[model samples]
Target chain A: MNGPSIQKPEIEFTDNIRDRNRYGRLWVYIFRFSTIIGIIALATLLFNIINQSSGYVVYEAKGDPAALTLDGVPIEEQTKDQLMRVLSSHLSKGAYSKLDRTKPFAERSRNDVYDLVVERIVKYEVVDSWLLWDSLTRKDEITAAVEEEYPEALLRFDVWINSDFLRRPQSSNPVIAGVRTAVLGSLWTIGITILFAFPLGVMAAIYLTEYAGDSWANRIIQTNINNLAGVPSIIYGILGLAIFVRALEPLTSGTLFGVTDPTSANGRTILSAGLTLGLLVLPLIIINAQEAIRAVPNSLRHAGYGLGATKWQTVWSHVLPNAIPGILTGTILAISRAIGETAPLVVIGASTVIYFDPEGPFSKFTTLPIQIYQWTSRPQDEFRFLAAAAILVLLALLLTLNAVAVLLRNRYSRRY
Target chain B: MEQIALGYPKSRNGLKRRFRVGENAILALLFISGVFSIFTTIGIVYELGKEALLFFRTPNVDLWSFLSGTQWQPHIDKFGILPLFTSTLITSLFAMLIAAPLGMGAAIYLSEYASEKVRGFLKPILEILAGIPTIVYGYFALTFMTPLLRTIFGRDVVEIYNTASAGLVMGILILPMIASMAEDALSAVPNALREAAYGLGGTKLEVALKVVVPAAISGIAAAFIVGISRAIGETMIVAVAAGAGPNFTFNPFKGAETMTGHIVRISGGDLSYDSIDYNSIFAIGLMLFFVTLTLNLISQQVVRRFREVYE
Candidate 1:
């Protein structure tokens, strides 16, 4: 008591949350740091997109401007970025083509030339960007006056929502950028992966649940299967490269050490991609499917037996129906993992791109993520915006699939 | 000798009095496919192992040097596994450092703190990060993430291909697994324990940390182990963001390769399977296989041994 003992505050209803922020400071710091990072990454992507999207300006002379014929009608025009590139290229090519050939480069007002280009776009001589942000915000005064003045000069504006972006192939000019081949490729490959993996996984599961004895033989088999599930997926790609593309093709073609079928997609096709992915997801499906089948009540099986139904009949008609929800859940999760897998595809060397939509299982193709990877890796900032848009599309697709799976799970669960 | 699966009560077959011999046949067939899958696994392993054996027999692949040496340039005649393994371990550890806490915190909030309505909204959003493809994550790491990390820290804190960026992005990639599975483990704890803790004047935090988590320790360990297993096997993100060099240092600012990275590198090349380079891929693959296999086995055993709690 002589040491000036501090008296602890008495417990009170109001004191329940004393220094509420103090106790969990570590956790709160971590939570805040994580949340801030997540938000910051998202914000950075968005801001970079908006910045790159604010491209440079361009201008063109009225009579001598570059012209393109649309539906046999000649139109002279320029978008800001396009105008800048064209002007820069022309100026670089020759002295006379420069905006102020006689004036000092520093003294020349290229801004006037830029305005003239914008004026020409406004004058209906050409179309402005169809980019949705600029279009929706419609700088009407900037574009409308030119259209009204150039009654004879047809104006074309770039609209971001045109069907062509999704309906066309990628072009050298990004103004006509599209993901048609890549989208179709992913769809077809995914279709194949699901088709191949699902039946095999389910069947393997059925065998495991209904069969496998307790002897060492069965145990070893089970242990090996579990280990197989843990193998790194890139190894599967190596297997595919050796087995599917190289060795088997030659043997399967009925040729002696010669896989000389010129027409054969150079041995890499959607079929190869699908099979590789199937192998990767196969172990997951089998394990989960087995668990799902095992979860079904034994009482139901006994009832089926009591009714004098055969074993196969009992399983097909009764056990399967009851186990539907678990099987579905397993399949959906497996599919979700498969959809996001990129490593094996890379190891197998998935075609970087294809100009045409896939015509068969043998046709070469790329996926959205691959395209996004290629685009984001580029030095140009415009491609980054395109990559972001593609990511948004991919995110929407994945979310919708997962939602459907969840919805089905809920709907089936209620019946049980 | 006529085939009759069953018989009426009036005229029972000799086999009906005991058990039908045919029952064994059906069970046998079911077990055969399990046997078949095992055979497939063995066949693949055998193929890889045989090639690797051949590689070791040659003077070119020095197993001792590969395992202990600092260099890992297989392309230009240097063979070292140490630096690659070190990078693999370092990146995986960094990823675990970030993901384990964030993921577990999210798990705790969902299980013990959030109302059902809040959980409903939060869980799906958490998975949003997971559903983004590994390739997309790789791009995000290279383009968006590296620059951000550079800005926050000084430029010296970053490399063209840094492990920190890839590891952090990979942490985000694997977060859903830890969160969802850990939540399952947390919820599996009996409500009675929580009630008893509250009865003893314990707060929600006390009940959760003391009773629920302790009870689910085995499952939580399984989650962490599985999460790390995934991080090790994950490929594209590391390949793109984490440079292919096998730097033996512990710096996350530097670039390094993992086993999966080496496999990708060889296969990505248009190399013939008969070559020494191609065989090296199999050798590395076998290593990856065993490493991940051990992790999975440990996880399975942990769950089996300590997970049970009677309701």
Candidate 2:
């Protein structure tokens, strides 16, 4: 009796799981399918863009000119000031000149039309053909561009490899068919959008994340922000039109434009376009930034408090720096989305007809998506090709920006 | 509890008191921002709300009519949003169907079958694919996927703008959502459970399906809902790949316009402020926002309930 002990019962249920296939085979199939799908998707995207972009016929030489020679000949014989005037297009009198030929593509690409009086166009060994597209389509406009710059060599105009329709700006002449103005417009617009939105977005995020105690108010704000992020962006367009365009026209400009006359943009300048876009992106920026800020530990905040620091000091000294990487990632994403935005800008009266680069924040501008849409909608086949090329460039810029953001976030992630 | 003196000092130090006072002002500063955000939110709501109310005041503003009607011609007379709403939900649901299985499959492979090394490589790659801009994916779906889809099933299978292609690409985007979330939930299951299953002579697949998955059911469900929200809010890919005309149809093969797509199309057409036409955007925006918010809230609550967090 002393030796006897209570015994635990033996487990009796049998699994009897007679699986047919090796587990690895099933998993291998799944993983392989996933990778294949992803790769194909990415490859198809890049390949289509490259194929379309490469098919574009680069003109021997082309661009906007300030004056027309009326005789269609090369401008190599023209003087420096005349070429400068031609390059400036009567907008401003900036000096320009002949860049050295036989340089690398990067250097050659840098040479403006003003610098290319004798300078070579991009990546072509053609010594004599002036950089220009044929006036086959544009009898009048072609004559004007040829008369302006190629007064000497206009007769020898053949499509060269230096200036594909992708590299130039919109003009009455197909010779000026490129995305330069659009690309710059996108840059400036997105730049302004970032500058306006970043501070406010980060501040709001900081307030929400590092400061707000868990409460009904905080929860409500968080919910509202997330919902705002989901709100169709066109609504923001309506908002921008009402609040920024019509209602605040006086603040934008007294006469709509600084000029004595009023235009469609009237007071609707690059600033207004950027501000509208800024508002559109602000909710996303705040949400992502809040997530980043929240990732920083409460222990870090407590440590600072334990050290007799104030909440502001603790956040500044510890929280923000820790969250910087995430904040940057979110900012970059917001910017990427802003760069691709077209709808809101169109509604806010972005000038679809602009030919010149925006002169200032007050000046009107057009961006990549807008320009692409204009080209895509047109009946011209060449314009479609040009649109494809422009898309490639836009994609590259967006990708590079996002990649850098991700890289930075990843690199810094290790430290924390 | 024993560190009673750790509490903030009741009296200020003379030398540091000014700094201390400034420091104390931080709470107020933060509180002020909270107040400011509140006001800003109110301002937006007021602006949008006023426009929506104004729209309702106009003749023949019936909520039921808007919900059930098919046409979306705001300028002429009939402004039915049902077609667009239907398209949005259908595309999102279609994407969920394709993505859920593939995503769950990948998750199972990741959590149960793959070694740590494979996981590291695959996870980052998948994320990178997911990280690529939706704009790029939009282009891909249109150019690449459409052609392939057409090849498999005639030209009728793919339209220049159709739900089928977009749903496919959106499925790819949601892949990461399901994978990461499912992995998180599945990985949360205890090792002891797996060992117990093995001791009972269960196969790996059996153990995964019967024990691990059931344990993580709530999380997996939440992941799928979050994926739905992601799909609903998805804009660029739809704008690019899916056609602009908002058709009221359930067929995935046909060109259907989503709510976001309609917004894009309208915004592109240059409507001036508060045009009875323009107020339609605000109403739609409110609808989209509410749907997504509810989905997100459900997702969050589900995660909280499912999260084990055992020490």
TM-score per model over all chains: 0.77, 0.76
Error of 2 at A393 (Å): 2.1
Number of the top TM-score candidate: 1
Give a tens-digit lDDT track for model 1, residues A42-113: 455445444433332122234444443233433333334454554454444464354444343355344434
For candidate 1, write residues B1-311 as lDDT tens digits.
11122222234455444354565465445555456567557656776788778777767667897788788776677777888888888778878987788778778777877778867777766666566677777777887678877888878878878888889888877776787888899999888888998898766666777888999888999999988998888888788788875678788888888777767766655666578887787777777777787898999899999986666
lDDT of 2 by residue, A1-416 (tens): 79889776698755433333476357568755764565565566566655544322323333323234413544645555455444444333222222222232234333344344323222122222211222344445655664665454334443321354446556534434667788788888888898888887888887777656577777788777765665555657656766777678866543544454224456567777888898888888888888888888888888998998866788888889889898999889888888887767766777777766666676777888877666655545455455566677777787798789879887987443
DockQ of each: 0.33, 0.32
Write down the worst ten-residue block by lDDT for model 2 chain B.
B1-10
The DockQ assigned to candidate 1 is: 0.33
List the TM values for chain B, per candidate.
0.88, 0.89
Local accuracy of candidate 2 as per-residue lDDT tens digits, B1-311: 11211224444655443345664465555555445445545656666677777776677777777777888776566778889988888879878887798788878778888888978878876776666656556666666666677788788665667888888889888887788889888998999999999899777777888889998888899889888988887776777677878788888778888988777667665566667877777777667766876887788788788666655
Model 1, native contacts kept: 0.39
**Model 2 Cα shift for residue B129 (angstroms):** 3.0
Q: Pick the candidate with the highest DockQ.
A: 1
**How many backbone clashes are present in model 2?**
22
Off by over 4 Å in 1: A1-72, A75-162, A170-177, A213-226, A251-266, B1-13, B17-33, B244-248
